[model samples]
Target: MAQSTEAIFIPHHVDEAFEVSYAEAAPDFGPLARDRIPVRSMAAGDLVALVEIDSRITGRKRVKYFERKLQDALSESDVRVSLVAELDGVAVGFIMARVDLGEFGRVDTTAVLDTIGVHPDYQHRGVGQALISQLLMNLGTLRVENLRTEVDWNDRVLLGYLDRCGFRPSQQLCFDRSLG
Candidate 1:
């Protein structure tokens, strides 16, 4: 018997937005079992799982921060995109980002990757990559031309991951100052 699958493509209303959902047969990832991994659009109820994942990775709780970000992302779907990866029905990874129609007067759309986290136990098992891949796919459907992320210079692991995911240094520089 053949297996059944479904794909959904959701359309965004913003300018140049593309459809971002489709159904497909189950993917065979060679030795990497694909059936156990699932990525989907993030919902408001996923906040608790996101917070737990971030807490496990950072060794501290920042519930308020995630609450605000999640609320913003959920409330603004046209400009924001967020995804979650699940393993056996439990969220193991997530990526959050938003689309900027123009920055610094440039007319091209750009995606800003705000936060990504993977539970430590799932770090090297393709959870993070799965989350990012879904994000990129969604952004592509939205006709976003570029993706940007900022990382502390000391974060070698994240930098390496971003590099492996095809992110390169941009010509523009990022400047920041503490209000305090």
Candidate 2:
């Protein structure tokens, strides 16, 4: 067999040859499942469901705690920001938050996310994101500039989820003192 040399030429286009175009299907910025899930302000009727969801996650029922939170969320705030994610017309997840006009003499308005819970069956779905998205929208409309939450350092799963949802460490340091 005779040895032969072959040169393959590939075609290239100049920048001017074509107009800049975007992809027909837009990039996946984030999950759209959150939009499909129905997120709405928590109603007085949602307390039972909220307590059930929390009990499932924490292995204990805190009816009194949820009762107090729901009361404050519904009655104390002029605008309700706490939300529940519903699927099949049942509450599957909830985020309890409150708008603080000022804390420690800071004049800026901020939202304190006291608690969030999603049924185990709904975990890893967009239920949590939906609650957060609705909460953010509600807070934004109220002119609240910040949302803050505290998670135990040991709870890595919750930490990772919040991190994915764009939460970062705050500049303020929290302290606690024993009253006993």
User: Top model by lDDT, which number?
Assistant: 2
* Model 1 error, position 106 (Å): 1.4
In Å, residue 66's CA in model 2 sits off its true spot by: 0.7
How well is each residue in 1-180 modelled by candidate 2, as lDDT tens digits? Answer: 011244433347646665543322221212354578988888999989999999999999999999999999999987778889999998999999998999798999889999999999999888887787777766766878888999999999999998877788988889999999
Top candidate on TM-score is 2
Worst 10 residues of 2 by lDDT: 22-31
User: Candidate 1 on 1-180: residue-level lDDT in tens?
Assistant: 112366544545545655443224432222132224688888989989999999998988999999999997889657658888898789899989988888688999888899999999998888876776667666767888788989998999989988776677888888889999
Candidate 1 local lDDT, residue 164 = 71
Model 2 regions more than 4 Å off: 1-31
lDDT on C-alpha atoms for all candidate structures:
0.78, 0.82
TM-score of each: 0.78, 0.81
